[model samples]
Target: MDTYITNKIMAVITTASNVSPGGAPVFKCQSKDDLYSITANLEAILDGIAHALNDEIYIIVKH
Candidate 1:
């Protein structure tokens, strides 16, 4: 058996303005569609996994 742990956040994509900019880079999108589009692109470009925290927020994490 094998196991792995992922805890690093590479980036953030969100449609909400209230989200605070933490240690990772934050990308603000104008709409839900834009958020999804950018998140997907970043996931591929950054070689990370996209995790939907909610309808308006997504965090890219490296595995």
Candidate 2:
């Protein structure tokens, strides 16, 4: 099982623009069971951060 999570972090890096670079999302898991647990935790964290930010978060599953 493979899990992917992408979340936008910063909005701007320098005075160039407010367009922040895409954050390299990550997940931690060993097997199917661990995958589920890790994905769940990541979802919760992303949920909280997304609530007060203009960023996008997504999850993808591949077998």
How many steric overlaps are in each model, in order? Answer: 0, 0
Q: Looking at model 2, report the run of 10 residues with the lowest lDDT sum.
A: 10-19
What TM-scores do the predictions have? Answer: 0.86, 0.36
Q: Which stretches of candidate 2 lie over 4 Å from their true place?
A: 1-23, 48-63
Among residues 3 or more apart in sequence or in different chains, the pairs in candidate 2 whose N, CA or C atoms overlap within 3 Å are none
| Local accuracy of candidate 2 as per-residue lDDT tens digits, 11-43 | 211222333345444433335455445445554
Q: Pick the candidate with the highest lDDT.
A: 1
What shift in Å separates residue 16 of candidate 2 from its native position after superposition?
37
Misplaced by over 4 Å in model 1 are 1-6
Local accuracy of candidate 1 as per-residue lDDT tens digits, 8-48:
89999999999989899999999888998999999999889
Top candidate, metric TM-score: 1
lDDT of every predicted structure (CA atoms) = 0.92, 0.37
